[model samples]
Target: RLPVRVDVPVEELTRDDGLFLVGTPRGVLRARNVVLASGSLNCPKRPPASADLPATLRQLDSSAYRNAAELEQGAVLVVGSGQSGGQIAADLALAGRPVFLATSRAGRLVRHYRGSDIFNWMTLSGYLDVPRREIVLPSGKLPPRGLLGATHTISLQSLSAQGVVLLGRFMGIENDSLIFGDNLDEHMRFADESSADVKRFIDDYIRRARLNAPPAEDDPAEMIAPRLPSPPIHSIELATSGIRSVIWCTAFRGDFPY
Candidate 1:
């Protein structure tokens, strides 16, 4: 049986004589071929603007947020629109707390489509298992995962319908006000296009494979689009906004030391 190490903090990793030398608190271990299974998401990433946020307002990383009952008695400002940000904002709003979401260009996905889970369609379409070498992006980087609810579809439009105020890309704090970019419409459009692209990919796969999948059903949640602010909100004075807490659901970073 192969040996496994648990609760061992790797202090350093080195290569010598075609062998990997791992230094841990206990001792050094040698192996012919080492597989680094240490994950990349070891630290929460907050925007540089986070440093300029007002001192009185409470700020918590997305990783630290548990529930609305723990927050102060005021509105919440979720400063991202990825999976965590969207879900947290939805959770707070559903719990009867006012929530303001600073949106990003992150895409959305429907949990279930065409009488099957979206993952099933993805596996059948051969898109889920595409090799890394086959991925081609303009910047030669991998694409980020889109926002998909755990058991239901979550979209910007649906969040707006639930009384959560949506704002544009957060620029920074200016003169005690939260400055935002004037691209809320563009952000929303991008989410719609992303969902449409995925649906189109699955549709093409079904047609090419001659699979007799049931017809697509209209998701009423996605159809609800609240009228966006004209010219988009460029700034909101923090003092008057009633926002007492800010959740930095921005992203995570790899904390690899080698």
Candidate 2:
């Protein structure tokens, strides 16, 4: 059995002669082997233009955000369309607050497709177990961020249906207006392509494994249905837009002072 220390805050760590010296509030402790499990989401990132906002506007990052009830009384502008930003914007809109979502090129996946959860197919296909070294992409390119939630598909398209005003990637602050790009069409197309790629992979796996999965039923209405696209907003005047609060959900970084 191993001894566990409770409520002991680690102050410093150093190495000496193949041993680890840990300094804490009580005293210094030594160990032959050490493990560091500090997480990455502790440090939240904000847009570079966040500092230029007026003092009257309230700002909160994803780390400090709790719920829509705590936000100021007015329209809420959520920057970044990642998991946190999407969910928070949906929640706020559902709670009767006008939510404006500034979107980026984060691709999305359906929660369930072909009578199975997408994650189940990912596990069966060994996609989740790939080693980091085997992962490859073009130079200076990164993978798209996936949507967050369980057993339900939520995309910007769905959020737009629920009265969330979707804006393109936030550029910067210009005068009293927030500048945004006009890449809404490209972002939507990227999401659709990503979803199609995943579906194709699943279909190929089913065929190769000779699984007797039934063909997906066709929904004519759904296939022909057209969704109301989110109009691109080039810029938003903060003073005139009635936006009282801003939520920054860009990304997170690791901050280890030690």
Of the candidates shown, which would achieve the greatest lDDT relative to the real structure? Answer: 1
User: Which regions in candidate 2 have their CA more than 4 angstroms from the true location?
Assistant: 6-9, 16-18, 25-27, 129-141, 217-231
Query: Which model scores highest in TM-score?
Result: 1
Over the stretch 1-68, how does candidate 1's per-residue lDDT look in tens digits? 87887898889999889999999998999989877776878789898999999888999998999999
lDDT of 2 by residue, 14-104 (tens): 9999999999999989999878887755798787789998888899997788888898899999987767787888789879998888888
Residue 250 of model 1 has an lDDT of 81
User: Residue 108's C-alpha lDDT in candidate 2?
Assistant: 70
User: Candidate 2 overall Cα lDDT vs. reference?
Assistant: 0.77
TM-score of 1: 0.87
Q: Model 2: which ten-residue window has the lowest total lDDT?
A: 218-227
lDDT of 1 at 37: 79
